[model samples]
Target: MKISLVAPAASLFAGVVSAATGPFLTAVDSQTWIIGNEIWNMTQGPKYGVKLYYKDHDCVGNAVGHYVSYNGAANDLAWTSARIVKNGTHSGVPFIDILFTAAEGDMHWVIFSNQHGSYQYFVNRALPTLGEFRTLWRLDNTTFPNGRTVTKDGVLPPLADYLPENKIQDETWRTPDGKGYITKYDWTSWILAQDFYGVYGEETGFGSWYINPGKDYYNGDETKQELMVHRESATGDAVQLNMLHGTHFMVSSSDVFPQGKMWGPWLWYLNDGSRSDALSRSKTEFASWPYPWLEDEPYQTRGSVSGQLTLSDGRPASHAAVFLGDTLPSNKSSLDQGSTYYYTATTDASGHFTIPHVRVGSYGLQAWSGNNSAIEDVSSTFTLPSLTVSKNKETDLGALTWKISEKKKLFQVGSFDRFSYGFAHGGDPWQHGLVSSCPANLTYRVGCSTTKDWCFGQSTKGNWTIKFWNPATANANKSATLIVSLAGYSSGSSSTIWVNDAVVGNLTSGSVGSDGLVTHGLASDPSLYRSATAAGEWRYFEFEVKPGVLKEGKNEVKFQLTRETQWHGFMWDAIKLEW
Candidate 1:
């Protein structure tokens, strides 16, 4: 299958060193150092420090903090402390470039300041142990998959040669410009540290340590990462390489996941460019950048937004999630909305919310109240007027109330938190086959069934049913409203609502939802990413239930989807009926 380019944000790496004393180590000159089967030639390109940007969420929005020099505490062991030599700004966003030393063992750390205050960025959790480091090596004279030799710099050779026979299969696609090709390959291997040290490390090797690509340069906490090799022409023409995991190159080698590879679909982008140029480009591409978006980009100014929400009953809508976006509510999330600004925040106990570090722009507001038993009776999404946000300023949206249609409450199932938090088979939705492994008759009955009776997701159509009973006082004469809140969906996913053997309505999940069924994850999980999406957002569908549709007796509301493959399905947040 062909895949498109997905640009996450970029990570900058400054100083990385690999030291070992063995027969495989050799120094060609002051500009070249050959260690084992790998060669590091400093003369090939200019060396530069890595840039670090501090933002609230990952690499999103303008820099919230600035980096000063490192703390350099003497009590810290493992020589994991790197240095920050310089600080600068791009488009008014402050950033720092860090440097490291290879004394005893190469370790690096950087200090940054945000709205909270200045703090040291610990590499491995909050502990002061072995500091992790990353090195960017431009492969020169490497073997290609077609049995050809790549003489220039910035190439890849079937991953590091130390890996055991990987049995990797390569898939290639021609570049859009028709000038080069991008190859996708799978790398499955891990380094046994004891064996690795014996072959590479000097005597008095440390006991336990975790070393991978620097966090400032890449996400050191990702599993299931992959590697993509790009080949460009010798004419110095810019060749774009699309990566799924945002950053170009990343590696994790240690004792993290002993059962198997700690990483999932990890990725590495290989191209020809100076280390300085690569580091600079990474800072520019940090978060909110969609695929195919590169240099000469526009940076959005930072701002904050605050508001208060209350239910129609005048009670505070506590613990609700508020969303701000440039466009009206749709299936598209901020990640898929390309250039469209989106921000999120959660409401406090008093129904007040403040979304900080939002890119300066005009936005419409939407809020979803889920998991709150006190406000579970409320239906439909809450929306407010469009407001403009100014740089370095706060936009206060006065207290607004969410009012649902005046109708008699009939029945409800599950809570609307935009997630399948309490459902059966909900935790770790990625395990086994979410579709085939589900129970044949996934029927959930009200009163008799608990939250554990309902499955989190549905890939099979007409297999799931919600059985509810209508009492003598039930109101079936007036038209009813049936709300279906979505937790996740696949591409081209749609579902039909059936009530008491009568057709109710259908919902088409737009192009911006997670394929959680096939991906084996929830839409909100960071690890749940597709080519065109960063993270999935929650959405709800409201269908008008005719007067005669929902009867005053036993009622069965069935949810069916257009299931064609394992990737087609929908994960529900909640289902409610009001007459």
Candidate 2:
């Protein structure tokens, strides 16, 4: 049996559109929506920032499918309440409306009501069904499970729904009651006016709107056709949605590891599952910059860069690692230098790569295909051409053809022999057991700080362990080079590590190298490195695991700070294994 709905009369809806009938206008255009008003100020840092990873997600822990995350510190602060207003009439269906208030830890995840003598709380739910919000608020206390008190489902109308069938166009839609028309715009395609690193490209023009899929709920369901978005701040950062699968293709850019930043985005299920009438163009597609993320001025304008890689014979260079750099590194140990190269991507089988949302500034690209080579113009002395990016523009370098040349390799270790693990490549994915919990140190950061990349050193855990399995039985006979980037207090503070339950070396000796990178036997001493050092900063250390020590599998490396110092005991940004 089909459920029948009674929608408000069109004439009645039109008349009530003004606050005169109630208190405020219910309908809002894309131009006048709450884009920045819902900023989710995260405190944990960048690792939680939006990038296209967690689309259509729910309120989960550190999982990759959450809509927003902030510092646990900000969880107790007061936030503004959001009020919903209807934009047009819907097909006749009776619905209820109410006010919602956030609860414990600013979990804003609550819909309140009273059932008899007990209270019902609806929070942290999946994306509510279209035309019917699964939660409403009135009273409060706290009950789990289902609620049947004074509650009515709220609804949000979607912009369009064309997928696996056709594209959507801008058109009017109505409620099942055939009494109202939805005229507000929802989806936005923000142009590349800024780089992914909070760097803007254009000052003004050809784009009034920017795209951000901020705070959304339950976005990654495969059963529905929905969209999701996340934006940290006002520029560069963005999230992509797959309306077909009702999810975001997060793993697309493997290097866009989460950092942490602001976020917001809300979506609705299409009235019709397989089709939509979404707008193909908007004022942004034409021109304008409504809101500018005012930070440092130059960080605002953004642009794009695209090019093809080919070998001397005209064949494409497939699977080449491409990097657009602000600074150059000496080698793998130059963790700080590598971070200066903000943009990183791998080429497709066709040898073509495009790095969009690049900060408009002076930059160069380096390609690694068995050898390190720069993409440069014929007359240029550098390996790469002096490239430039303009706001709302694409800097296209037709084809970068390369010929085999003598070069040094970053890693000479054999077959996946170099097991690279670090916060720079996204924190420890293996069994990193902790003897003590790490304290949330404020100085901890992403990219380069003290010439080190990212690390798990933002806390005061005296004993922490990072373990891995050397599964290659055939490769078990050789020694492994364990290079680590780390820092700690030198005032009675000491660094210690146990490989395979055996102590290797100790660093109480103040003089390791001018650069502060300590090396036991293999790798260059600090004096040999190009990185500059100061009193209190990060340093590098290389330790060669002795042969006959590492068995076939299940090897462990334990780290402990011998003496208590300051700032989270000891800190590290990366851990590299090369044999």
Candidate 3:
């Protein structure tokens, strides 16, 4: 039985054809809808700024699948909310439908009811043939133990029923120990269907397992699909999901090693009628599943890139990193949607590097050497002629040289490795309590100060003093550059430098704001992963030191966070004085 729904006659959804809603408006054309107000805009950032466009055939136009975009660039349509659906009519008026699909491919919907004066929403699934929508915010359908599809018994239909015809069966699947069974359907669908029986059926076990299948595309080719199995264990025995090769295809399970491509999902069920030695048996079976990941490659459609890197002084930049990346958006976030279309490789001992299996596209090349306190750090962004890669070809950039800026250094506080590694609390930067525990007025003397004397980052708006001694007389004729390297900075905040009493340098804004002070890592969020690196992209601010600014005996330089709050702060990478 196909259970359709209808909205009430007089409600917030009255006169759908005659009235215009706040969020939803009548379409001006097949692809355009004139919104009543700005439901979402680009200035609001990614969370609320993203827009999804879908066609509503009921609005006198051809209906089409929705497409998603962030700011203005197109993004995948899956995994995002903000959907609009229109269901059956009520008293000659159409109303909004709230049914949605879950990541696990389950059907769920929301129902509305009248509270005091507004509407309240409740959620449930389409099972058990519930005539009323009063289930109250949960999918509480119990498991059925029958050995059939369970459509008549109030359970989710078999997964095969929803899959396409070509993907219905997998006859090549087998257990790790050579125990195999023949199924009328494809082996992949058959195994998933058998597991679906135990999964949808309730068991008072210590752990629960579910399948979350995902796809992996190599350079926009989606021929490979991987299963992501999640184990929700109550006893804390399961591991968390991890990303591999920047692909979202991941598995969360227990006691298994992750390989390159041949890695598959394994379930460890611990309940009644299960073996007591399941952990040991599962480990042995996991080892026997496959050898090194050896999947067939689409080399005919992909290409490779090779290049050599050398310092300005004609020395090999051994172990340096080279990147071939697409053009970044105007305002780059801390992490841009997981590094897709970006390829990286490391130089060999002789500074030769080769990146394999790269999709054919035009890319911008960048290279940077590793950290070396002996000499200054060197990095370069190349703007050469169009570098267009073609199919089944190897693009060689030949020999490339990086030029380092020459400077007569007087003194330096840190290296240009793009980190706050040596400063105080640098190793563990998430300690927000340090703002109150440490002294408000912090001071650092050039010769006597140790790494512990300097804080990793500044959290509040204040002036931190740095005292340095100079033996030479002050010379206004000779030019000097005071370089300040920052690893992270918050939005709408500024940093200013004052030498003795005159302002030397000021940074008013950045491309995009980052959370660096409270969480001293480059990653978007510290709760997801606490990184040892700095918070955001590296930015250099060079201030000129006027002749009379530096005195012979002693001079004071102040670094101030002019507009700072607890949440708005920046992390310092290094400071240097060069003539």
Candidate 4:
């Protein structure tokens, strides 16, 4: 079985809705109903207020009973005498009698007695179940006949102001361990007022008292030896008290002060079963003035690549292989099929690839094999400077380049996944085309290539340039260039270069010839560029940028690659960046 706890209905409306009735309603007309000799009614247009009535015992007649008023509205009320009801002799205290009424609006009643004290009752709209009740006065020695004079006025000083500021000295009692100890002292030397801490409790009767020592308490044999006690406070009058049994204190009002009456800032330690071993004296004073405390904010980082790819003819290209390399090629000889070092990827149908959670570092990029050919390839390298990628910020690498292939099939000859490549030539090609296989040095091949002309059949190769800019900052920008040169060729064929969507710039490829070089500028707002050259010999390609395009703060510049054909080998070299 399962049970759920809910707030009491009385607390919901603060006792506004009486359980006996629904709720009260106010009216304009004045009317009255007689409950015994007491006339009860609404006055002054049913406004919210409290009222008092003075009468002798016979005036109300009933000792205990309930009454209902029915003039213009209904009112449920109950009344009882001040007599206390007792339970088991010493088991618990007695209950006090009270009068209660439920009206439409806010109203309350105050009961006072010449011999007893005063108490206030409220029909709280905030606590419907437990009608509000507060004790305003209590019978004590100070307020008794020969005690301090009484005042009906409401003004009163703060409790702390009337209490002594000094700590009292006492005799300490030890526990079994000899470490745990307690001391007892009396406040009669400094206090002449009544005991304010002693308040009324339902179960303990009207005069029951509870004390807080603002420190720890102990229990043990006290008859063995007397322990000197030291005070913890800084000022006022002091008195010495003796500790008995480590639990009780021997205090006498007459022995410590001139006045026979004893008023106290009493101290007591409770040993209730649940808190026996863990219990300590209450720190009530410290609770009044608590200590102070500070708090901090939270922190995160992420990465991604733009979606989309562009061809050399300036059209969106889908399904292109894109690779990301960690380091730039060292020299022209490093752009070989089996010699180059980098990580790679392929673009989706939307020409986009997302690499999430990328670390901050340098990188080289390439794209290939889009239209099932080995003729088109583009490559570029860049560095993401020291950037602190905090939560919510995005670093964008604008674009990367891939060189185009000249063969009928856009890919070189044998380009598998983005990571590795193959060529169809055996001769030492310029763009670092490795010789993987050779049939008597005629049918030369590299990687997984089959034809010598497809791999080493070009004179000058294409070049790609990339310009990176950090839009997050004003002076954040940088540029990198990649050149792929072909050393041999049979004929000149137009090679298609596919730039990833993040690439921005002219889509046309510049021509190259034997022992000649072609250069292109990548210039576009919020974009980088990638391009491929026709099958041929090429040399000395350069990429430069105005300082400050790449920033020091959080920044991103992306370069993606795509191929016109599926199988082809592309080389990358002269990969350099200017600031």
Candidate 5:
């Protein structure tokens, strides 16, 4: 997909990690780490939850703690953390630990490592035992009228408990040949350990004894407790990986012992080799975990997510948005949005949405109609019981109903409201961010696309990209369409524009197709894009997205152009994603 070439999108997984700022208040309680003579810290706010701080070359004291770092947003969390190390993983860096509260209750430990490909896929090649940790969730519906509605009400059982073919890891880190076992951690608190470890463990080496943090009131007679996470590794594609559980120190009057687990056994993915094949096989093999997005990317994982959302009165919620959200809200949530929803899709006229290729997890299935901001009534924005999806499986939430205030018409999708696309990238200079190539009169914004900034009329292939976030469910019959046009280009010549893999139309003249797509250029207007003499003037072009093309979540649209002649001009007027 050449996906990694583009800049990272906005954060989607809000429940796991929230955006943070620097200068993490000196007033708050926090842990500071030293790495290569640098200080990094995560402020555990007294009022809020957590805030991360690190040494930035640009900050006032060369220490960044005052301003929020979009760099730490959900979408960029892996990249941001991986930049610290040499290699990257699907979730976070290997062995990097973070403490969090579960959606139900009790404190939990989850490490950021796994063989899972990219973000949501799995892979192979064993090395770090840290790679054995992945996440798992279970559906709980006890609160529903049916007595078993979908809900994220419990923890995923250990891999060995459910997957008969899975191998269990109970070996300790220091003692490799020995079976992995949790040991009592009489070490100091996490903050104290950070003080000793520094940012990258440049200080003392013993800090590894208690890496992941734990809670207070453990065993007895202690205000707080420390924990050391432990897990073993398994071989082969059929076996599910084990969760990393912590062993707290049991301190008696004299001797100490290791006992107590943070959570039941969970799972991680060891790629069967590539992500697509692994996720497909993972669902059938890893019976211990739930993976809702197993059916996306037909070319890859073949995981698909399809569901039907209905209104309270039993009417089809055409254009309703069905999305995935974390069962639990992290203390590090957005200060504005207030929810942990990450993935989304719009429903069709029949209230159906199909999004394929999602990773495994128990998610809060939520649906909404009207605009995203229009979700006011509790019924309009309620979570179905937790919906569980497995790899290469279709998670169909059949005809689920919600309470609505009034009946509404089918949602009318439209072009972006002159909004600047947040992301773009490729080999071309003008198409990328070399806005200086634009006319002197036109100012450029990093996230904005404009008329002066269009594809160069060079003969070689070049790519320009713009993306949109779709919150509506997938509509088999009502897929998203594009409203694209250009100005001031070669008069009377055809320039092809490709969306996805198909050439929808030509960018030569303003002509409307039977599908409602119109492609135009100054070739006919003689103005707009520039003077009639401009070499690459294409104006007022549009392409109707065929039904069943677009999906939910972040939709990236690319503009690939080629020059038929030496006509060196074209301006981007409208390259919008609509339906």
Candidate 6:
């Protein structure tokens, strides 16, 4: 499956540091100190008492100079607070303390001093008990004053200032035209103190304590409250205020006073401590039309269609289609045509459907919903034999019985008879046998030829009778005759036997035999008889043309042959009918 890739948009404030200085800084030489000069440069004038001198002819004398020098001579009261020295020159001791105090609000201060050719800035802030002072910022002179400044309120100026004049800072935050300051709090000490201490302390005689606009802040007075407010309304219910260092203050407060829940609804927006509230109160309302509603039920087959859908109320929805295709509409195609054996169905109100009786091949299933336009499409293929029905016979195929007959060399035997018979002497010669006379007696006599040896060594003088019914009437009409012939013996010299048209009792000669053969007689018979020719020989016979006596629906013809000698046995073949 191929998936689409989306390109992410460029970040709007990618390199903007949430803190007063870039996170990384290094000093290369003792004379060159990397310092967060933006705080000093913005709060104090460019020619303040601090001087950062670069050795290799790098220091230039200009309004924004590489060597920042005061307007007065050194060591004098004016110079004490005015002239900043790099190497403690006779003109003045490098007023590192002045540059250090320039970067302070409240009691926290950062100072830079030359050592060899490199410079290092150190910090000193008053903590309750811990003597460890925290380092706030740093910068490399090569990169510093590059195009940044620290405002008196501790905010960094736009990079355009130190960058060549031609390069304009990207127009990001809209500038207020003819406005004295970009932000009303730009000149406030509360903002500067917030930048230094990262928290609003007690309100000063100068102005109101700088609490986050609309954010609840605990005041020292405990009764009256102060908060920043947006006079103009915005679309979203909540507003965002630049709390300066309030994030660190809140985190520190939570850590120090572990028992108090200092942090309210503010959630960290990113790795930085900046935060945004839950959108629960946002004016932008979002909603989905319908919901998904399928369980992980196994499909009947691999190709079977399955899915889920949901309703607008964010609840499980039923009857919504998850697929659509050739297999749908569980009902018949048309009222006049009746139902097809295969179709699809929607789930009940609970959204469940099982489509049975599908063809034993691949088919498509689709889902649909009346509410939402389109949800999703899944392609599946299933193979199941239960879905198919046999097309050939109208009758139910419960069981089948098939038989192979040895005597007739036929494939199937619908019916057969088990009987024995013999002929009576001088009774039309062909009508010499008494056929099927006893039902309880199992023994039958076989008549043997006078020329052949007989069983018990006695002359085979008497004729025997055998009789059976041919219930196979699948064949009818057209000169049907039963012919009997012998196997397992060579014979040319037996007396002629006869076939009769008799339905019961004595047989009348209808055909005569010659050379141990039953001749084609003029009349077709319901009863057929053949005389034995030789000892130990097996004779088999069937109807040549179906007899006229055989009725159309079903008829039985009985065949009987005499076995005079008791040792001679007979074998019968299944009756065969050909149309």
**Tens-digit lDDT track of model 1 for 181-284:** 33322111111100100000112111111122212122221121222222222221111121211221111111121111111111121112223333343343
Candidate ranking (lDDT, best to worst): 1, 3, 2, 5, 4, 6
**Per-residue lDDT over 1-579 for candidate 3, one digit per residue giving the tens place of the 0 to 100 score:** 011123342332233322433223332223232222111100111112112111111111121112212211122213222233433333343333332232212211211111000011212222121111111110111221111111111222232223233221222222233343212111011111122212223242221122112111111111111111211211111111112221111111111111212112232122221222333434443454221121224212568889887777777867665656545431332122222344556678778889776667776666554344233344233333346677879999899876765766666666565556577655343322233333446788988987668776665667878887767774434667787776555444466678777777666553434433211222221210111223334555667887777777777778776775443355666777776
Stretch of 10 with least lDDT, candidate 6 = 288-297
What's the C-alpha lDDT at position 165 in model 6? Answer: 28
Tell me the lDDT of candidate 6: 0.22
On the 0 to 100 scale, the lDDT of residue 134 in model 4 is 16
Per-residue CA lDDT of model 2 for 194-236, tens digit only, reads 1111111121100111122221122211111111222211121
For model 3 the TM-score comes to 0.47
TM-score to native of every candidate shown: 0.49, 0.29, 0.47, 0.20, 0.22, 0.15
* C-alpha positional error of residue 110 in candidate 6 after TM-score superposition, expressed in Å: 99
After aligning candidate 2 to the native by TM-score, how far in Å is the CA of 442 from where it should be? 23
Residue-wise C-alpha lDDT for candidate 4, range 378-461, written one tens digit per residue: 332222322332334444544433333222211222222222123343212111112222111222122243432333222223
TM-score, structure 5 vs. true: 0.22
**Across residues 154-237, which tens digit of lDDT does each residue of candidate 6 receive?**
223333222232322211122333221121112222221121111110121011011111112121110011112111111111
Q: Which candidate achieves the best lDDT against the true structure?
A: 1
Choose 2 or 5, whichever is better by lDDT. 2
Which residue segments of model 2 deviate by more than 4 Å? 1-304, 308-352, 356-362, 366-462, 466-477, 485-494, 501-542, 546-555, 565-576
The clash count for each model shown is: 16, 60, 7, 91, 68, 62
Worst 10 residues of 5 by lDDT: 143-152
